[model samples]
Target: MLNSINTNPGALLALQNLNATNTELTTTQSRINTGKKIANAKDNGAIWSMAKMQSASSSSLNAVKDSLQRGQSTIDVALAAGDTITDLLMKMKEKALAASDTSLNSTSLKALKADFDSLRDQITKAAENAKFNGVSLVAGSAKPLVFLANADGGNFTVNAQTLGLQGLGLSTTGTTFTTAAEAGSMISKMTAALLTATNKLSALGTASTGLDTHLTFIGKLQDSLDAGVGNLVDADLAKESAKLQSLQTKQQLGVQALSIANQSPQSILSLFKG
Candidate 1:
């Protein structure tokens, strides 16, 4: 049974080869244009998920670091104001000692009293106005600020301890001192006040140090998160360069293969002439 259908085997093979070459060319073009092997979720699901998680972690850690820095600044301002108040109180004590000297004239003593009163008022004013980011740490107004490290808790919370000056009888005016001895008596009452202020300053320093330590740990966590994110999504120039070279080579080979496939139908002409 000799059938007379004119079907060329080379032409069919050429069409198949051409389709394969075209497919490879398309894939190489996609990789080159997009600059990513795994451009979509369907490409590599696990890597995509990991990259997303790393990105999210980096964002959260960055926010936490910003908050910690602001907290540190707030603590610094409060500590400085506290120390200033203590210094002013020390100066007032020196003036009070001068006022109690019997050799000083009455006018001189009254002048010293006026200066002492002004210094006391300034101390009170400083305490009342000492605020950071609108949150007061002195004058017994602000709530205790807390910082927690992890989800399970068990982190440090720095409390704003009182300086214990509630009964010092240290006021600007209204109380009369009859003599130098009476004025001198007030120093004993003020002794506890000065000591308490000094102690509070020390406590503030300790608390500030603790905050700084915690912030340092937070910064380390942020650095780790940044590294993880970079590892996940950042472009590897060395690997990318190699892949690009391979893709370019494959593209050239595909073009050559396609040209040969297109020329395969010409071979049928030779068979026809024979």
Candidate 2:
């Protein structure tokens, strides 16, 4: 080989190796500082894209959980009202039976009617007041209460049936009793009304239970998705720490190698002196 004075190939190769080690050191430090292996798409395109999509979906599922919780509250209120109304109906039944007797006069019948009216009014108020977040599941809106059950708004839904005085057969416009004979005829109607209210309570109870189960499931699902995203995007700190120490040590060796290569041309000077 012809020894060239102008250029040293060994020194150039050592410099290149040093620069490569420096670049690797920078990357390892960045991973340590940020705690993310793929901080951006530039780091790893496919992994970054998948992580972004999963993160957005997790965010959307959180919103759905909120909606489901609100819906559950509304259903709970309606259920409470229905249960109260059912108890009131039982009281009304007692009053109706007492007034249906021939032994009761006009005054007693009128008093019984007043007590019955009071119970009916209370039932109306209960139904009307059963609202959550401005939504009355038991009154006004006949439409079923719909809640998002999934991350995507289009996919799944939970529905609760609407209930009210009319739905419960406790509407004030019906079954008025003026006389003892009329009161006697209304006993069966009151019993039927109580049955209807009990049934409505059952339906609400079933729906509330379903919402609770779904909420639990959704919570676990979110946890899994988060873990998955973290696995894909989060840096392995232990591994990165080891890599950083290795890179730093390697960089020092690279610098020493380059210095030795630069000194090699000095050996050629010894040949000229001899």
Candidate 3:
């Protein structure tokens, strides 16, 4: 049943083998160029979806980490300002005690009052200026930052945690210091203010410690997310090298098979001549 005019059986076999070899070559070329077994969603739909999910989760956690960093900076500023206020209060107490001495006349007491007033001004300035990136946390204008509820299958929030100072008040009145018998009374009032400032500073220190722990947690989460992202996209040189070698061997074998199939028609030629 050989159709001699149009087709030779041997030639047809060779063509078929060549086609198969070309298909294999094309596939190998694709894998080499992309370096990924699954280049498209059609290749591995399930794995692609999983990788996308992991990427989205990483993005959310990265945002949370950024918020935590900013929170840490804000809390740091508050802690410094609080400590400075405490120190200034203590200095004012010392000045008041000195002014209460009987040996000092009215002029000396007046100068001491001026020094105490300067100290008060410095405290107010420190509190008012304790800010981070235009966000004031110590001037009684800021509230503790809270993360909003996450509704998008996320466990992290986008907002930072705020740390601020409170219960700090200042007065400029020197009436309790101006009288002779009331010198002891003035000392008592300044002492109370000093104690209050000390207590507030202690509370702030505790809150800052808590924020530090939270910061550490967020840092670890960020590191983990970074590693996950790398795992998804990063190449494994060893695995790729092995795959390249295997593909090269297969390609060589395919070429040899194709050449042998093309030479099959020569056998037919020998049969016709001899």
The most accurate candidate by lDDT is: 2
Candidate 3 lDDT, 1-274, residue by residue in tens: 5535345665566567667756655655565677555566776687666667766776776566566577667767876887787787778778878887888889988788778778877776787788887765566555555431122433322222221223443465542366434555666766777677677656656666765676677567657766775565445656766766776676677667667756655665665785
lDDT of 1 at 161: 47
* lDDT of each residue in 1-274, candidate 2, tens digit only: 5577789898999999999999988888999999999999999999999999999888888988998888778887888877787888888888889889999888989999899878878877877788887787677464577788898674333444444557766557675678888778768878998888787678778888988998898899999999999999889999999999999999999999999988888888888884
Q: Is candidate 2 or candidate 3 better by TM-score?
A: 2
Q: After superposition, how far is residue 93 of candidate 3 from its true place, in Å?
A: 0.4
Position 92, candidate 2: lDDT: 82
For residues 1-274, could you state the per-residue lDDT of candidate 1 as single tens digits? Answer: 2222355454455567657655655655565566555566666789777877766765676556666576677677777777777777777777777777888888888888877777777776777677777865666465677655532343556667443134234555632253577668656656767887777777778888877887788777767867775565455555666665776676576567657655655655676784
Per-prediction tally of clashes = 0, 1, 1
**Model 1 TM:** 0.79
Arranged by lDDT with the best first, the candidates are 2, 1, 3
Best by TM-score: 2
